[model samples]
Target: MFRNARLSLFLPFLVCVCANGAALAQSLPQPASQNGISYITGGVGEDEVQAFRAAAPGYNLRMTFASKTGSYLSDIDVTITSGAGRSVLSVRTEGPFLFVRLPAGRYQIGAQTRHITETRKIQVPAHGGADLRFYWEDPDRHGVMRVCKSCPDTARP
Candidate 1:
């Protein structure tokens, strides 16, 4: 009887781990199938390069402000809403990547930093994974979007 109970508990633990495995493998935008409207996070595909472009929804977006160079942005406002304008995840900082799971629909993507506010639309497939990066500028500086290469994944965002 004790062995049976232990097995039951261990079985559930394994199932849960598998269920959340993808969440651990990646942090942003889960993998999706075609049909749903998903946001292509980071600067992935800005154009309609994929064959099933219209059949699905997605976008390649990037916010460039402090990302130019040495100027590290202090604050950032990223508002991710569903197709119906329902609130999803509203992030406010230059931290780690953010991932939100939705039933695939129209979405409004926007970001605001010390001196800029940008908004755009993204269509995500049923289960497609999108990539997006927000780079905030400082006042009036222009340069290349530089990410911290030395930044460690184990490090806190």
Candidate 2:
């Protein structure tokens, strides 16, 4: 009888925890699909951004967009193409951050806003990953572009 009472008391707590967990899970961002490419694309909120960053490593590339003054920018166009110039991933994120899964290879990553387009070359390791950051400056305020450490930009076309 005592054991039964203990379980009965714990049951309410368990139910409450499970219900809260389900709600939180539902609030998390879900993977999106565009042009047959499946990607995780949301980080507008504080918690959602944390979740996105936490889940980033599993993806092949983490693309982030920001202004020249270091302000986060959203809805920027991002495109990933193979070394042979084939489109691999093309997406426009609602937030400043986007995570995509690509096969290990060399590719060109292009990020564009209304007035500027920044391009970088990246080579995903056969066993590791990479990060691409686009800092968009104004037309006249443009400066040197930064390349990913893992991938070298040997040639610019």
Candidate 3:
């Protein structure tokens, strides 16, 4: 009975999320020369994956994730959301680096942590080359997710 009551309470929240997702979907832009988003995903050891998303009109983005000496990050997934909150591009990495193509627009790029999720928005120009970045802490200590526009520094962990 308790589980059922909890599920009922959460149902509306799930619906709202779905509704917002639908409202955010927008058409991908196609330029006379090219159409698609460009992305890069990879990190070293524990910080194995790093991702960058740039809008067509945006500047070139450069990303850097802080890590230990030997190990690197892995399994980093980045989704590019339009300034309006629609998911415009999505990329996940299985190997060291993944390169994707995208149209130019304002984008919100999110970096994943075991507990926390970090997000950064970037603009990509029509041709190529934009500088953008995001950073987050490991969940080894906090066990909670924290979001940030820029990389975050914690008291501990």
Model 1 per-residue lDDT tens digits across residues 5-108: 99999999999977665443343333332234233322123222121232223333333324654454535677877788777656554332333455566788
Q: Note the residue pairs that clash in candidate 2.
A: none
Q: After superposition, how far is residue 11 of candidate 2 from its true place, in Å?
A: 11
Deviation of model 3 at 53, angstroms: 17
Which residue segments of model 1 deviate by more than 4 Å? Answer: 1-66, 70-74, 94-96, 138-157
Give RMSD (Å) of candidate 2 vs. truth.
9.7
Q: Write the per-residue lDDT of candidate 3 for residues 77-148, one digit (tens) a residue.
A: 656677888776565544333344555667777866464567776775666666543444443434555577
Supply the global lDDT for candidate 2. 0.78
lDDT (CA) for every model shown? Answer: 0.51, 0.78, 0.50
Which of the two candidates, 1 or 2, achieves a greater lDDT against the reference? 2
Q: What's the residue-level lDDT of 6 in candidate 2?
A: 98
Query: Which digits, one per residue and each the tens of the lDDT, describe model 2 over residues 1-157?
Result: 9999999999999999888666556655787766566688767777676677667877878888888778788989888888999887787888888888777889998888875788899898877678888887643445546578677655443
Worst 10 residues of 1 by lDDT: 43-52
Clashes of 3: 46
Tell me, by TM-score, which candidate is best: 2
For candidate 1, what is the TM-score?
0.41
